[model samples]
Target: MDHDVVLAVDIGGTKISAGLVGADGQVHRQSEVATPATRPLLEEAMRGLLTSVADGASPRAIGLASAGPVDPPRGRVSPVNITAWRDFPLLDLVGAIMPGVPSVLVGDGIAAALGEHWLGAGRGVEAMLGIVVSTGVGGGLVLNGEAYAGPSGNAGHIGHVVADPAGPLCSCGATGCVEAYASGPSMVRWAQSQGWTGPDARALSADAARGDAVALAAFDRGAQALARGIAATAALCDLDRVVIGGGVSAAGEVLFAPLRKHLDGFLTLGYVRRLTVVPFELGRSAGLLGAARSALPTAQFESPTPA
Candidate 1:
């Protein structure tokens, strides 16, 4: 390693992105590829991306942020989106890729939160909720100026929080989860049930932008469910800010309008009323930066306990 650079990895179901982040927290070079569903193909795709991104520069440390169920005590990760990686030795494998370099593993949500706190929308907040509302809902918290991943390193799973008792069942076999109502597919499904006939959330957003009643109602419903979760999170954590990013978040005013309205309705407590919610500042780069931040040495940031 020539300098204190971080080899950051952002692993998701759709893709795996790797970057060589310099000491200043900027990614100088990066590479990404589709995530193969199978084990062997996944390994090949991931390794190639890592090698390509390194670009002949050895990194001092590696930070990996993968969708989880991170086994902190075992250094393995079982991302709910990636079925091939059930308790996969991600930390060990990444470390092995650059022998003698230290590696850190954390949940993707937690990584996003850390990244935001350091260089994005949550830059100045003491308590923040960072959420991703894409194919699924995922979230993490930075409380009292430190990332809180709990004992097993998967604490801020706000997506699974129950927003309505009468809501539909989630893929995790539970009913009334925030994800069941707020995720892109969930909103689309609800719209379809109401005879909207939309093919996907993207089209739904476009229709909503044109003021289609049914599409607007679909976003409204998802916003309501998301509101419940956000309000509850604020109440519990006394949050100062909420930053949301992902594909569904791109709906802009169509989603935020109803989200703010429902959030206000649910904010019965005066103390939590001032919480600010906004779009993610870092966008697609947040996860990579957050993963890189995990390798930096500072009290403002901390890594999940090694499994």
Candidate 2:
């Protein structure tokens, strides 16, 4: 059967979203559900989700965007939040569901970066980084008009980059990682430790918006850590722009103002100093769009096109 669209799936710790996307990157039909807890349930959920969007039309290819760490060369994934899966053969499972269609997988950060570069905030930029700052800090890169996932598909993991050797311990067992300070939970934890009694990142943002001193201080600290990571990345990759998104990024100036301020101080190199940081325009749909883009034959990095 000749196919007119691609099946794009974005799998995160909290939710799984699937959609039928055309070559133009428009999502025709989409649906999502909360992530299942166990491997069996998760598999079942994915099958059902894909089946729903692919009801009648034949998909040219299946593209998956999953939370890291992932092995794209092996078509496997083991996201930190989804403890039920470890080296899960996600590509094989998608192949099983749709027999002959080609399927490709990429890290969520890579997908977001590629998607932003294609049609969002970083469009037309020569080199850029896309960042997600929610539960954890995540990043990906687009260089010279191409998405670079590296050989291991873990190239742009800026969150794991050390920001302060003496800072807090990270979930990955690293000390003072960008994630340790800039993640939503990290910022909240710092505020709480400082006697700012916020229940969550949302509350912390609200407090900061109201000019609460401790909450503001918490964001400042997180911003400084994030700035350190961003500066390093920009310097190393010669990035021209950065697009930041995710739940915490919605805090508006509560995050960007301090981030830009700290970034300005950290970026002393002339080439890296001109890097423009902007908010993502695609909101939560960047991953889905990027997955779809990856499936397209014209994508800079893609598998063999099906006939």
Candidate 3:
């Protein structure tokens, strides 16, 4: 139980991924599989995923990052998208699968921030926020070189933050939340309401790239809301940098161009205006490495010694 390596797991609505990681920030023998709908199926898939990745290498500790809202105190999870796992005791399940090793759990947003800060886009920043702009908007704070999850492990959940009072309603039963404007579906929904025929965010991005006025306008609007949220976070956190990732962010300049412009308009204070926004450098590996790093301190490698 004295190895530098740890078991890292990233569980989401659509997929489950597992890997073995070390302090060097490398994830090896990673394996991924579609997430099943039922809890039993999920456990079965997870076991397979872990077994495939672990091979004969037993990690000392386990770090798990899952879609939330999660209760770290009780080691439970209730992800919105994963219906069968309401208040599921994730820690216990992981412990059962990989016994005799300590495990740590955190929201994926926080894990992403830690990952980006340790080795990705937020590297070397004193205070930062990692934003995932996908189906939903998620925010994670990395303040003073460490993650700040706050009480209830929900400090940086910025999706519900009011960015526009007159904006659309959010899934969290709030109006004008940033997620209602900048989330991929939200942007596409707005575009469709305006006669843009694209079915998803990807098509919208393509249309915007080709100079489709309505599509471009959709991105512009989404960027405008995202800018408001980012500026608000920067103002409050006095952040040195912000890193954006996820599917919608992959739209590249289609998203960042207007985002920068709108962000400039919202940034008032000089100190906050200095915050630099960038895309995540680690891509999909961010959460994995983040979980690995977070679990490293407690990692207790034993048994199944690398054969």
Top lDDT model: 2
Candidate 1 vs candidate 2, lDDT winner: 2
lDDT of 1 by residue, 242-281 (tens): 9998789999999999999998889889889989999999
TM-score of each: 0.92, 0.93, 0.91
> Model 1 TM-score?
0.92
Q: Write the per-residue lDDT of candidate 3 for residues 1-307, one digit (tens) a residue.
A: 2255788998876567788886678766688898899989998998888777776776778889887778998999987657899999999987888888789998888888899998899888889998877767777899888899888886788777899888788876789999899988899999999998879999999999999999999999999988998898888889999899877889999999999999888999999988899999988778778788778767544434231
- For model 1, state the Cα shift of residue 45 in Å: 1.4
Put down candidate 2 lDDT per residue, 8-36, tens digits, no spaces: 99898778999988777778899999999
lDDT of each: 0.84, 0.88, 0.84
Q: How many residue pairs clash (N, CA or C atoms closer than 3 angstroms) in each of the candidate models, in the order given?
A: 5, 0, 5
Worst 10 residues of 3 by lDDT: 298-307
| Candidate 2: residue pairs that collide | none
What global local distance difference test value does model 1 have? 0.84
RMSD of each: 4.0, 3.1, 3.3
- Best TM-score among the predictions, by candidate number: 2
